[model samples]
Target: MRAEVDRFRRGAALAALLGEWSTGPGPLYRKLADALSRVAEEGALEVGERLPSERELARSLAVSRSTVVAAYDELRARDVLDRRRGSGTRVNGRNRGPRGDGRVRGGQGTAIFQRLIDGPGPAISLACAADEAAVEVGQVMREVVAKDLDELLSEPGYHPHGLPALRQAIAERYTRFGLPTTADEVLVTTGAHQALGLLSQVYLRPGATVVTESPSWSPCLDIFREAGVSLVAVPLDEEGIDPNGLAAALAEHEPALLYVMPSFHNPAGVLMSSARRRAVAELASRHGVAVVEDNAYAGQNLSPTASLPAPLGAYAEAGSETLTLESFKGIWGGLRIGWIRGPVGIIERCARRKALADLGSPVFEQAVAARLVPRMEEIGERQVVSRRQQCALLERLLADRLAGWTWRRPDGGSSLWVRLPDGASADVFAQLALRHGVEVIPGSTMDPSGAHDDHLRIPFARPRREVEELVDRLALAWTELRRHGPREETPIRPIV
Candidate 1:
C-alpha cells in the first residue's frame, strides 16, 4: 500500500519534528535509532513515509553519514523500517498495524494545520483563533499599488532580509512601543507562523531543551516537536507564566530557547505582568538562553483601564539573544506579513534559513504592510471595540446556557480560554461540538504534556447572531454528549 504522508524534504524540518534525543547511557547510533522509533510510534513519522537519505540526514544532524547508516540499519533490523532497493526507506506499516480508514496511526495527535485537509469543511469554524480581514487591509493594498506600483514593478523583487523600507517601518514600530531597534535587526517572513518555524531552525538542536508555557500556540508546539528538542512546559496563571517556575526551568533545563507569548497570550489570553516579563528576560539572559517573544497580539487590548507592558525585547539586556515576532496576522488572519527583530547576526542567519525555506515573502504583501504597520495601532483600536462587543455576547450566551463553565476575562484577544467541567474532555467535547455545526480547539492540543484535557479555546470572531446560535447549539450538543456519552476513548483525535 502506498500510504499518503507528508514528507520532510529538508533534514531541518525532520529534525524539528524529531525533538531532543537523550544524551545518556548509549551509543550515538543506538540513541538515534530509539528516537526515530519513538517518533514513528507517536505517528509523527507516519508509517510508509520515506526517511531522508542517510547522507542528507547526517548533514542536517551534523553527524557522520556512517552514524545515520548504523541507525537506519538498527531500525531495519528491529522491523521498524523497510529498506528496499530504489524504493527508499519508509516506516514499516506491518509494524505500525492496520490503517483501516486510510488515516495514519496516532494521526489525531498532530497539530490542526498539520492534519490532512480533505472532504467537506466544517459548518462553523471557531477553531481558527483569528478574525476576518480588517477594513484597513483593503485600503492599504489599494494605496500601496497606487503609490509603489511603478517602483515595485521595475524591481527584481527578491529581498531575503525583507524590503528595506518595510523593515525600517517594523523597526520604527518597535521603537515607538519602547524597544530601540534598527532596520538591520529585522528579517521579514511570510507570517508569524513562519517566523517561529525559522527561529526553531536556527536555535533548536537534537538533544537540546526548549522551555515554553504549558498551553501555548499549538502550531508552535508542533514546530518545537519537529526540531527534536526536549520541551519543558511551564504552567501559566493569572499573572501569565510563573516567574519562579520559569527561573527553575531555565536553571534546570538550560534550554536552547525560551518561547513566550507575553502580550495577550494566545489561547489563554493572559498577558505576562511587567515584573514577570523583566524577570523572564533576566533569567534567559543569565542562562544564555535565546528568547522568542511572540508579540502577535501586542496591541489588541480592549480594556479601558488595562495597561500592557513593553515587549520583552525591551526588557532583555544588551548582550542577550532575543527575537521579537510581530505580524499583521493578528490584524487579519489572511494577512501574510510578519517580521522578526533581533540581533543583527541572528537576523542574518534566520534570513538565510528563510531564503532556503522560500525565496522571499510576496513583495506586494510587504509593500502593503510597510504602508499599514505604522498605522497598526489605529487599526487595532477599532478591532478592539468590535472584539469587546463579540466577547460580551459570548459571555452572556455562555452564562445563560452553560452554567459552571468558567473563563478568565482577557484584556484583549480573539478567543476565550474556557475551563470545562471536570471529567469533560475538551477533545471529546470538540468531537461532539462539530456535529452541532460548531468547532472548538481542545485545550489539550495546546498543552505540551496533554494535561489541559478539560479546557477549550473558543474564537469570538464571528457575527453576534452566529455566535448566539453557536452557543445555543453547543448547549444542545453538550446535553446529547452527556446522554449518549462520547464516541472516542481518547482525549484527542485528528481535528482537521
Candidate 2:
C-alpha cells in the first residue's frame, strides 16, 4: 500500500510538470521554465502550493540542479511565478489581475482594428478584413427586414438588443444545440457584448466571483471588472478547462456565475470534450451556480463538430439556476447583434434588468434578427464554403513555408493554434507585423489581462488571395520581430 501511494504521488507530480506544454527542446533551463509556466497557467501548481526542490525535481526529470534554478528565476521575473526561502516556487494566484471596464472589446487587440481594412475607397471604403455578414439571408427574412424598416422607419433605429422574431429564431437554434428553449427564454441584445453585459449586471455584486479560462478572449473583461467581479481563471488545454482545478474553484469560491466558450473556444481554436462539458453541467447544477454560455462564435463550426446535450437550463429544473446562450453577427461581426438564451423565468428577470439598462434592443434590428436567426444553418453552410477554400490555401502555405512551426488543425474553428519552438512570443510577433503593415492577435490578448505572450491566433476566414498575402506578410513580420524584439507595450488601447 505504501508503494502504491508513493507511485501515485510521483505520477501526479509528473503530470503537473507536463501541464499544457512540453519542455523537451532548447536549453535545459528554458525547457524547465516553459514547463513551469504551463503548469502555473493551468492551476495545477496553485498559488500557495510548494514546488518540489531543485534537487528533488532534477533527480526525477534527470536534469542538473543549476538548470532548475535558472528556470525558477525566469518565472519569478515574470511575476506569474514565485518562491519563498522556506517554501518553493508556486503560481501567482488566479485572482491577481487588474480591474476591467464594462462592455466587450473585440478580443483580437490590434491597432489595425480601426483602420478601414480595404484602404481608401472608390464607391465606398469596405471593411474587407472583417468577415462579411451572410449574403444568403432568406427572402422571407428580407421581407421581415423590410417590414422592420417600415415599422421603425420613423424612430431612431438602434436598440440595445434586437427584434423579437430574431430572438425566437435564436431560441430555436439553442433548441437544436440541445436546449428546450422558448422565445421569452431569449433576450435580444446589442450582440454577444450586450448579452454578456446583461450577465455581468444580473448576477455579479462588487467583488463577487466569475470563473473563466486563461488565454480567454480579452475584450470581454471590460464588464466583468466593472461589475466588480473577481475572476478565477482556469487555463485552457486542448481538451478545454482544467477539470480538477474547476471543481476546486467551485468549492473554494462558491461563485455566483461561470462564463465559458466551451464550443470551439476562442484563440485555442478547439471545443471542450463532451465529458468535460457534461462534468461542467453537473458541477454547475450541483452548486446552484449560474453558467453564462457565450455561443457568440459557436455557429461558425466548419469541421466535424462537437455538440453538447443541452444548455444548463436543459439539465436543471426551472428557477434553479440560470444560463445564457449567445449568437450574433449573422455569420460575421459587422452587424453587432446576438442573443441570450435561458429559462424564461430567469430571462424575464433579466428582461427587467435589461429594461432598466436599455428600454429594449432596437425594435427593427430585432425584427431583422428574427428573420436571420432561423437561417443559421444556411449561414454556416455559406461560411463553410468559404472556410473549405481558405483552409486549403492555408494548409498549402503552411506545408510549403511553415514546416518548422507545428500546428493543430482545429476540428471546427477558423484559426490554427501553432506551437512555436524556442520560447518565442506571439504578442511580440504581432507587434513586429506592424513593421510589415500586417496585423496579428498575440496570445496575451486572449488572457484576462495581457498574459500568454507566446501564442497567436492568425485567422484564415478571409479570401484565399488575401490570406496568402497575410501568410507572406507574417513571415516577414516574424523575421523582423526576431531581429528587433517585441515592443515594450501596446501603442493603442480601445475603450470597449
The candidate scoring highest on lDDT is: 1
**Each prediction's Cα lDDT score?**
0.78, 0.61
C-alpha lDDT (0 to 100) for residue 327 of candidate 2: 61
Measured against the true structure, the TM-scores of the candidates, in listed sequence, are: 0.77, 0.68
| Candidate 1: tens digits of C-alpha lDDT, residues 1-496 | 4345545554534653443342346666777788788767666667688888987776555455777788888889788999979878888855564334343222223325423332225456554666778888999889888889999999999998999899999889889879998999999999898999898988888989989998887777878877777889999988778888999999998899999998888888888998888988888988999999998888678675576788898998889998999888667867788889999999989999999988899999889889988888877776777888888989889989998789998867778888988667675566456556665567766877767878888888788788888899889878877776633211122357
lDDT per residue, candidate 2, 1-496, as tens digits? 2211221122223422342222233565676677666545654344555566766654434345676677777778777666766645655665333324211122232222233432442211111224655665445457866665666677676543345556667767777867767777777766777778777777889979988888776556656867877878877777778878788888999988888887667767667776677777788777778887665666666663534335545555455665765665436565556667776666776677777777776665566566676676666766766776776778779667654666677755666666655767654454345345554555654666456666666667767677777777777756655564432221122358
> Which of the numbered candidates is closest to the native, going by highest TM-score?
1
- Badly placed stretches (over 4 Å) of model 2 are 1-130, 138-141, 145-162, 304-309, 317-319, 449-451, 483-496
Q: Which ten residues in a row have the lowest lDDT in candidate 1?
A: 486-495
**Candidate 1 similarity to native, TM-score:** 0.77
Cα deviation in Å at residue 152, candidate 2? 6.0
